[model samples]
Target: MTGLAIAFLILSITIVWGGLVASILFLRSRPEPAEYPPGGVDDHREDIGPAERDT
Candidate 1:
């Protein structure tokens, strides 16, 4: 492959793999919340206050 093509290939691969590694590290450090809010999908907005919600 030409030099520019090789450079772009390397750049794309680095971006994809770098994002995967960064996300794994970030999630490992902060982790997801253990406890979800009381409501399931339909009523998941229970945590929002009435004044802030649209009618």
Candidate 2:
């Protein structure tokens, strides 16, 4: 095998392996779940008044 071919092969393998490892780590991580109470929408906009009608 030529030197250039060997070098290209090694570079490709390293890049592919690194990408696989990163994907696995990202998939393993978990995010916290959000909680919402009943009547959540009402609680959010209760203080805002209705829009005024145009003359």
Candidate 3:
């Protein structure tokens, strides 16, 4: 029974550790703000200057 308890404890610890590592990796792999520039079709056009819109 002790062996089973130890094995379960190890598995729980491993799962928690794996979750933490995965979260860190995901955060690290996130794209920077510069990676995706602004101004898609749905973006606010009113904010742009009149000269820019004329171009």
Candidate 4:
């Protein structure tokens, strides 16, 4: 019974730590959100203004 309890404790700890590590890695890999102002442009473009372009 003692051996079984030790094994169960180790397994549960491993699972919990593994999930925590995976969640950290997953969230680290995602891009952050950038909200637009009210009634602002709802587009996803990297267009530079013609005059603002470096000659």
Runs with alpha carbons beyond 4 Å of true place in candidate 2: 31-55
Off by over 4 Å in 3: 31-55
**Best-fitting candidate, measured by TM-score?**
1
Which is the better candidate, 2 or 3, if ranked by lDDT? 2
Q: List the lowest-lDDT window of 10 residues for candidate 2.
A: 30-39
Error of 1 at 21 (Å): 0.2
Per-candidate local distance difference test: 0.84, 0.80, 0.78, 0.78
Clashes of each: 0, 0, 0, 0
Q: What TM-score does each of the candidates earn?
A: 0.60, 0.50, 0.53, 0.53
Question: CA lDDT of 52 in candidate 4?
Answer: 59
Could you tell me which 10 consecutive residues in candidate 3 have the lowest summed lDDT? 31-40
lDDT of 3: 0.78
**By lDDT, who's the top model here?**
1
lDDT (Cα) of model 2: 0.80
Put down candidate 4 lDDT per residue, 1-55, tens digits, no spaces.
7999999999999999999999999888875547777545665554644355566
Q: How many clashing pairs in candidate 4?
A: 0
After superposition on all CA atoms, what RMSD does each candidate show versus the true structure?
A: 6.5, 7.7, 8.9, 9.2
Model 4 TM-score (2 dp): 0.53
Q: On residues 1-55, what C-alpha lDDT tens digit does candidate 1 reach at each position?
A: 9999999999999999999999999999989666666564455576676466566
